[model samples]
Target chain A: MTSPLEQKKIRITGPSVVTANRTWDGAVVYRTAKQGWSTELADSAIVSTSDDARALLAEATADDVGAVGPYIAPVELKDGGKVKPGNLREHIRAKGVTIDLQVPA
Target chain B: MYAYDELDRTLINERVSEFRDQVKRRLSGELTEDEFKILRLQNGVYLQLHAYMFRVAIPYGTLSSKQLRRLAHVARRYDRGYGHFTTRQNIQFNWIKLAELPDALADLAEVGIHAMQTSGNNMRNVTSDQWAGVAPGEIEDPRIWSEIIRQHTTLHPEFSFLPRKFKIAITAAEHDRAAIKIHDIGLRLHKNADGETGFEVLVGGGLGRTPFIAKTIKPFVSGRDILSYIEAILRVYNQYGRRDNIYKARIKILVHELGIEKFAKEVDEEWKAMGDVGLTLDHTAIEEVRSRFSYPAYEKLPHMPDELKQAAHDKLFERWRKNSVSAHKVQGYSIVTLSLKPVGGPPGDASAEQMDAVADLADKYSFGEIRVGHEQNLALPHVAKRDLPVLFKALDRLGLATPNVNLVTDIIACPGLDYCSLANARSIPIAQELTRRFANHDTADLIGRLHINISGCINACGHHHVGHIGILGVEKNGEEFYQITIGGRADENAQLGTLIGPAVPYAEVADVIEDIVEAYLALRDRPEELFVDTVKRLGVEPIRERVYATR
Candidate 1:
């Protein structure tokens, strides 16, 4: 069976952003409009078309100093410059564990 | 229960300092990510989907109360308030920060626990039967030999960077509770006709993308020469094991490529070449290792305790006792398994408060020692029979007394897509839904001794291949699907489960299991026959027909 990440053969749908894991801490980071990585999706550079998404991913991959495994992920923009992940996995990666962390202070 | 000596302490302390320097280099941009990845993995750190995960090995699954308390402290201080006890008898902290990992290792070192060889292509944590010393069997304690192997294999220069990760399991009992047949190297210690204790070495058994039951390479190797034999096997594997393909680099592949006879011949030749080396265990050193295991001051009481007899009449206590309690070698003692599979909760997960409570319970009742079973449950290996009621009450209050050992609700599942980056589906939710479906104690009791193991992918971390009812998660067109297998057994008569039919959707997994169990209920000759036995008698035809027919 093909991997879920490799099964995407359809046309690029709506807005998307190039995201990867920060190399040092493995935190999820997104490529920003200024060619830098940001932890917040709202600060990311949103690409409306497939060509721009591909270019943004190429740029992220070339500047791999800060992150690894860069890939284009779907995102939804909200009012007040907010953004949320378009898939359950990316959402989990952006936030934290799905279950209760329950860490005592 | 084995306390670290000066050499052990020095090795661990030095490794921690070295790792601290390596982490510093990585952060300072002096080391590449590729270089840092190997360094981090060597110390049991992995970069998962969310954050870094650190796995700490509980050698032979034995932990002192002090050690377990220290783990709880680490979980609360460095990570989230809980730790996930794994199927390999290790505990993993999933939310570990990369920067604080050195400090966490330092704390673990203070308690004689290090994350050495928990990952990487070297030898992983050595696992053994949870009831190694106390189980009702006439054999030597396997932990002693496991510790010997651990000491020998830790950072061994020749075997440090094997082609792939190697796992070894030692079981002294005849029942094979440790799932020895599914390990890379399985050592079963037994006595021969002349009453000489030795190990029957089995090699190449593994459950991954390709599953194979281990084959006996050596009929018997003397207890003294077991290390030499293992060294021979590793030497051969290190030389000829596949290194080109990561997927086929495990020793099992090599064993498969070269038949068992040829593999045995190569290992025997290597063993013969290393004649009378220092690898042969000295009796004095063996005795020293054996002396470290602390034995409780067991009192000579009657075979049956009065409290237990009284509790036997109570239905609730009787049910709990029937499921959670096991016969111990000692007359007045019992092996009490604390179920980590609470209803609607993740399997093998314990909160910090629960850890502290269990540690206290161990100190109060079972000689301050706890054992983590490969089944993902904690066992009080030497609990007095008279303290059953109070212990059960304490466990009940902590939500640890689920009374579902080997039952349908006692599910073994891997940290699939929920935590693992390699997973194709989510195993925890499937396990949770199944446990909820079988929440009724009466129903669970009716379906006795049904081991349901779920793995998110073919990696088989959940030992799904050996489960009586195995569930493997797959992906098709971005949707999660589950493949069901039936009649697998992981005991003395071990056999891999057969895949029933086409993969079912995630939504239909629990119902498919229900269908299989319902068919077993209808087709069984009697309730005395187990699910595996019934499948063996009637074959998978009935279950397969029923499962697919319903769908």
Candidate 2:
């Protein structure tokens, strides 16, 4: 099991054009988990291929979601999205990648 | 007190005008709240729970009588006829209107004071040992460097919007009265092997939610390279510090994540780039700034005043000695700490009238010098012993002669729920009630020096974690509850207090504290055993048993 710090770091990018206000660069990125993206904002989340991200992005629509807009696509793990809530190891086993949803440092 | 030169006076006056325009713009809706927040905060204005709070900087804890008089006038005209001194050597007026801030700044500027850089994510007001020039133990005056750093950082455009707010403290005394270890940057002025004075720099210390004692990044940085070294550390933090999470944005988290070795290496790398450029100590500038803080004329006199000698044998003078007098570097002169902790009164509070009286006392008896301590107390750093009787008589009439500067009743408490929007519980009333309960000055003196810090929330504005007897206020079912921590201190030897079992109700806090003190008295080896040593040897078990046993 990879330590949270050892997880592959990826930059989240390009949701800014769709954002209501100024879009940040390399703004949204997540790390790949064995299972699914970790719910913790600090944890690394999995990002699937752009096609999968596009499809998930289409299916998601919520009023609260609209204001913040275009939540990052769910990383479709080879296995499934099911995983323990906070257990990073189990999260990796279920979801291939976890979404790192925050502004870039 | 350091006198402001023409340039200093002009800059402050210009800053007041610039801020007045900004305030006008903000009130006119030309600037939105998001835009105005940073601007207002830079001027030390905060939109708090019930009203706006204006935090004015008392630079390096030093104030002239003119400045204090100006503060009193501001308090009377703009605020609620009182001012609250803070643990950071600043003053906060809780009832100022947003529109009145411009006028307040103007008033402060007229006397060479302003609220610039007291807040915001930039460098804050530089703090030093309150006993800077007068302490016999000091290697050199710390106020010189404090003033230097104050001028260097004030309105430094490039560093304004760093990852988070930064604080710096300098101490020349070995005892560390400035709480240097718990600042963002702590500088201990030390003499090298060759007897050359320089600094021992520490980085990443703070006392907010995630308390950390800064590490020594450089054991010794030459006094000349101080600015370059600080620039390096700040630049590294600015470039690599986490902006993603506000909680982890402090330089401490960066030092924690990357490790201090790596952080220090990065700072070293940056420091090399600015070598011999932008920082060469500009000899003339150093002299220019240093001249403002030059030593005052010292007069030779007998060590003991006959009147004070006769009075010390008196009951009243003995009580005052227990609480008020501290040793001064000059013979026949003493440092007098005037306690604001009157029973049932707010800690750090001074009414406009009281402030005027203090200013009067400073002008008349103490060379117009006043210093504010980090523990929310005020000091007259230079007082002739011969004037003690007259000063004491005047103070006694004003009710400023509490004589419990560092006693159990000298509680350091936050504004808490009464004023602060962030408080989880009420703090002032608890402090007031406790001070009332422990009303005996003699009893407090008997207990010896013990710090009691109370905070409304985990933000630790009152520095509860460092109190010898720390009380943390929490809310339960819309009522106030307090959790006690024992043995915490932020002296030369810093330690985080340990939790003592279950939390207590607000009303029972004073009794619980009494029980804890009584337990210490019983378990201690001798009267020489102060609160910290007693708690250290016996551990919390004895006090825990005594406190909860009553249940």
Q: What is the C-alpha RMSD of each candidate to the true structure, in Å?
A: 2.4, 12.8
Per-residue lDDT over B221-247 for candidate 2, one digit per residue giving the tens place of the 0 to 100 score: 877788888888888989998888878
The weakest ten consecutive residues by lDDT in model 2 chain B span B26-35
> What digit string (tens of lDDT, one per residue) describes model 1 on residues B53-108?
89999999999999899999998898878899999999999888777899999999
By summed lDDT, which 10 consecutive residues of candidate 2 chain A come out lowest? A16-25
Q: Which ranges of candidate 2 are over 4 A from the true structure?
A: A1-105
* Predicted complexes: DockQ each: 0.37, 0.02
For model 2 the TM-score comes to: 0.83
Best model per DockQ: 1
Q: Estimate, for each residue in A1-105, the C-alpha lDDT of model 1 and write its tens digit.
A: 233344354346888888877876677889999999999878899998988988898899776557766788888877875888876667777876566443221
Per-model TM-score versus the true fold: 0.95, 0.83
Model 1's chain A TM-score stands at: 0.84
